[model samples]
Target chain A: MNTESYLDSIRRGLRGAMESDERVYLIGEDLLDPYGGAFKVSKGLSTEFPKRVLTTPISESAITGLATGMAIRGLRPVVEIMFGDFLTLCTDQLVNSATKFPLMYRDKVRVPLVLRTPMGGGRGYGPTHSQSIEKMFLGVPGLTVVSPSLAHDPGTLLKRTILESERPVLWVEYKSLYPKQLLNGGDELRIWQVEGEDGYPLAVVENFSGSDPDVVVIAYGGASVPLFESMRRLIPEEIRVRGLLPSRLDTRTKTPWWFSEITGREPIIVAEHGTRGFTWGSEIAAELNLTFFGRLVAPVRRLADADNVVPAGRGLEREVLLNEEQLIKAIVESIT
Target chain B: MILIRYVEQSLLRLYAQGLMGGTVHTCIGQEGCAVGVVSAIDRQRDMLFSNHRGHGHYLAYCGDIHGLIAEIMGLPIGVCGGMGGSQHIQRENFYTNGIQGAGVPIAVGMGLAERFKGTGAVSLAFLGDGTFGEGAVYEAMNLAALWSAPTLFVVEHNGYAQSTPSSLQHAGDLSRRAEPFGIPVTRTEGADVIAVFEVANRLLGQIRAGKGPRLLFLDTHRFAPHSKGDDFRDREELERINRECDPIQRLAAQIGADTYEQVRKAAEIEVDIVLQELGVQ
Candidate 1:
């Protein structure tokens, strides 16, 4: 199973979404024919739900404002920001309008809206393109953030997100996760499932495998793959290690509770795809109560994009970047 | 209504006696402008956005005088639930906003929302002649016309924006300013409440009927100071204008008050009763 890719899984996820309700519709720029989107996941969506799907002008602010009004009037709209950097341009709609609506109206209204954007760093997609700005919205109380690292996980997480939550959801999908490998013998699609409250497996977390270990690494989005690959590279015997892809940021999932239960404390190394500032790294740390000793081995450390927005050249990129070796050194230093 | 002017005058008295906190932009002279427009507007189907000089607008729109008083007094029961002060009065259906041009965009957004909802509800934004120069007003006008938004832009031309007269501050004419945007414009005599009502109702009808946007410049007199503490005593024919421009006096004439004394005392009784309820002595 190429669990890394999200193409087939997302297709199945949309099918589940469409079958469950008629009100859920996708609307955004460059989503129509001749150009499915910056990525092709929405390529065939216009065909199946032609009337329901919409391709709009490049007005992010007005589009978000329109969606806010529509959501208030009982329409579930999913807006795809062409790039994560453009989310800043829609602050009037996002920060003040949508975030404050339910609280302002005292919960009489629910803005069942979703903003899905792509956040990836490997493609060297320069300054305007590669930032995991989803973390920037962590402090906002009314919004939920979901960062999925794999293709099928994306679809399943999206399906569960739409079905759940009374507030707005911000789903950040990594561009690298698209067109991932096929699962279930290359014909049938699958969703990695996690056990729900009723002891039945739910679509929140698809799979889990780790030995009894003292410390764990919790990561999300495209960065998760590299962390997983590094784990495989550093097979230190008997040290015990586990990994996490945070299914939902706004709501506490099994990750934090189980980790807190397992360690009798907070064991979190939250890695993100962008600059540490205006991001959720500190929020996660604060919530988990982990001391951020950044010397690669003291307390919990965060690996995010460097503060200065540098060019996407390989030399400058690798200098400020962290991969397998850095993770290992950090883990070894902590354990010792 | 006759009570609206009494409300403004009572508020001015409280402000002068140091019984109220914060400042009030008295609409003492422009009460007819608001009465003229809101009298013809459907309370349920139409909405009005007011300016800093919004007492007239609030009273004409049936905004609670207690809430207005509470607002000026910095009490929690103020129109914005006390979050907004005297300038930011907001009742159930009607509301005020921050700054000069902020309300215009919000009112424009409301009109847009109304359009999609198919309510046939017209939104009227009241601005002083000084506000005619605001960029948001122009932006609102352009969007309103482009969307054919059912909104009314009421410019209460009281001849002055604070101390500066419109003749010095505002360039061009109000009607001609609205003309380039294809907005139908009209001028109504603000001193004559009946004439004000006639123009207001006709324009409001077109708005509700979905016949585009209209701009009405109600040429009126400013009898009081721009604010609670400003000096605005008119020396040239001041007595005639104040005696003639009183909306309550004009309306009372039709009701046979016998003398201005009877009407004034009757209004004063109601004002005292209202002030008592507002926790004022």
Candidate 2:
């Protein structure tokens, strides 16, 4: 049985990219050997590839901008934003430079840097550290945003991004899923795979287990972990619901192709780690409504965190983030 | 430098005549910093990054005047396919960004890539005096010096960051700021192309020789206002700086007046031909 933790998988994927290509390197805060990154994702990587793994100063703007420069110079540089909240600092370079350059210059060059940041709130890291702000990057041209959950192998997805992706990739990992095993070994169901710019699969899991599904729950990243757990608790019978998990979230191409296969008036529920307003859930709902507007049984219900900054205390933090109870409530509300 | 002057002058004329679309930012008097530093550095191996006022930098390295004019004119044959205009120009190893000090850290990344590949190539970033306020520049300096990356930070200290003067912006000098990071700093006075070139050439030599990160603060001046229609500077002081430290005038003084006139005439003729080709008088 081949099993690996999500955190170890990300490290393996990084090592794979570096080992395979001399041009690929890692740059971020405390990513060097002894410290091995803030999350310990680069634990032993600096030891093996000392020169390739660089520990940079606390400059989020520089991290993104420098990686853009390296990418322009024909080097595959992956920058890790120590925390997801710090992405606000790097958005200047990420949005203005990394996203604009390739298309602005008519594809004369490509920025192939992967910005790997841990998102979502579970740990009591407070407002600055714990944030699921991937929604901010939605619809940003010339950039691809992907998140991994228990459904997809984080290592394989990361390797694909480094080795295969042409444009810039914003790879978001969650704090909760780092120590969990990927969802595998269940009854065979349809897998909706959307191929990215480089033909790498941006998977959307549609595990219905054969029976006619009454509702389809679409979720991603940290939200998917709780959604699946709630689904298992609610039902064991044949196809009362279908779980649709999409890992990629920008300028989507192939998701519409699979939309035609979902033939029913079954209510679609979009769950995410971001706050309720202006989220990836909104974008997904918009696209789904555009295609399946008439077929929808109800207005697409969205399950997400409260519209408030993530608090530091354990009890307050639990109250803000998405939980199993909320998922069950949204699912039941949509179907009824 | 002459071509840049003529092209930017034409752009201003077009803007006034309502011929161009957006407002323009020009580097009329600060041509020496762009031409000198870019000419002194390695275009084949090294990379160059610039700020908002970057027409001079583009023409200095790429020398594609026709492409630049087309870009400013929003023609389809522009350098960036009419997408980037003057502020965002991209060529082989040359890139210009509109943001203030965003290029510094990006330039650091290129320097790191050069070190990692053992290419012995240096990365040059052209920042304005206003960029001193940006914390990213210092962060980049720290990383570059800490890792000993071959990067050069060139500050075209044109006295003002937009409308704000250096004195009002900061308390002390620019060079002393980088001293705390252990990065070597060199300051050059005036906008003479020869003087700026000599200093940049020396600093670039050391950087390519693995001397880590270096900062060259070129004391230049922007003759024009910040952008197209923002005339808020002291006109008398602006005139004083221009008359005393005009880069082209300084160059003409070094070379003969006849030779300088001939160079300007040639650039004028080239600009005329490009304008004719684009059907714009």
Candidate 3:
């Protein structure tokens, strides 16, 4: 019965990292006491470690550069870029300087810099505030992009990103999932190897009712919410369904062997948080098609947000973002 | 001044002969600012961040002529393993970047780190007049002053930001912009190495003493174009300014003719040996 909210998990993880390592510290705008952070994930941390939590000016470019300089000088700096959209302002430092130093220096120096930001839509923050543009930085080498899904605890992943990672890591947190508590929370969120029991870092839950599954659903981050809910309502009494969740998107560490585990006539459905074209879901679908080419099944279908700006109103937002209805439709259509 | 002048002049010759890759921003008339500020600091303890026209700063701080030449020539044994050209060279405690006003805030971060670790070290960011127009510079200065971070921001005001003059790029006085942030500001006329050094030494001492951040605006002029293939300066005006404020000539005049010749000869021989060792023709 051990349960923790996603936001609380991140706070605990940050506190743990800062407490354990003297070199680890947090730097961002409005990260001090009283105003923990924009999302309040850094709540109470400033009070605990007064000297460690640094409140900075509204300069994402310099914030990133400062983190890079500190990392090179042997300090682990975790920079919080208030919103994911402002990550554009930090591209120069992130791409040219932070990502290049360790490799360019031939490992003589290490840039253990972590940039955490709130991404994804559903809160009606409009175009500038809400975004899931992790796909844009997918091609950047020497940078690791990780997303925490409902299946995995955010705290465990964040702690690993801070203490274990040797390169630059962009930890993307979804705003919608912040309030929800982990369903089956326990020690199940421990740091497992990439090639661990599941063959991936994803914390998957198999909810098959019958013997064989009619279709397999794969999703990540906030998008997995509707996928899980739709799978519950859409699966007929005769038909069975399986679910796969991925916490990390970069795939730089290890490739998921999910394709080999699920076979036969079961169709594959991939869902993602960002736009439909050239997204993380598409990447998974391509990998599935390549590995399971001879398997007898329908084409892998992908469900994602519409290719337009996330509108402000709730009705328009629902129309654009993936809903339970769309997931159910995709799941039902995949088997047919 | 002699070392920077020799490296820049030799690099200029190599650049003209097409032995170097990419654009080179030579600090021909602004050697005084680089040499002066670098000489005033404890190079082993203090960290430096440089902009595009950073060969002078690199030589003045690290004194690795062979490594710099190798990096410019794109050799395998370069400072950044030949990955970074002239614009980006990192070694020891010295780091350089080609982007404008990007490393200023980073210097502030290092300053914060130094204070946190109680290392008694200061971080210096070397920029050009071009960077004064950047919003990040003001942001960095504000943060540095607010947190009392030990950082020195040096603006080598050689008049032009690329081809555009400072009047076209910046408004009001540069030092006044920082005074509002409660950061101490210093404006010294460049071309006198000793003068730049004295002011830099004083400011660095204050910063090391935890007196917040300081800005030093060293006024000088560029003898060469901003970068490769950008000739837009008035030739007569340039000739007049170069004659009046040639830092090398100014320093040589102060040191006597015999010592000046010996220093120039030594610089040329040292550069020749470095270039020869790098197998650069």
Best by DockQ: 2
Worst 10 residues of 2 chain B by lDDT: B187-196
Each candidate's lDDT (Cα)?
Answer: 0.66, 0.82, 0.82
For all predictions in the order shown, the interface RMSD in Å is: 5.1, 1.5, 1.8
What is candidate 3's lDDT per residue for B22-68, written digit by digit as tens? 97889999999999999999977899988899999999987899888
Best prediction by TM-score: 2
Q: Which stretches of candidate 3 lie over 4 Å from their true place?
A: A185-200, A209-212, A235-238, A253-265, A293-296
lDDT (Cα, 0-100) at A75 in candidate 2: 93
**lDDT digits (tens) for residues B1-281 of candidate 1:** 55667787778888878987777788776777888888888888676778788887887788467767777777766655555566765554465543565456446556655665787877788888888766657766766677677888888887778888788987677657888989998987786788889988888888888888899988777788878766655667567778877665676676675766676787678777878887675
lDDT of 3 at A159: 82
lDDT of 1 at A176: 60
**In model 2, where do residues sit more than 4 Å from their true spots?**
A186-208, A236-239, A253-257
Q: Estimate each model's TM-score.
A: 0.71, 0.95, 0.94
DockQ category of candidate 1: incorrect
Look at candidate 2 and tell me the lDDT of residue B179: 85
Listed per model in order, the count of residue pairs whose N, CA or C atoms clash below 3 Å is 7, 2, 0
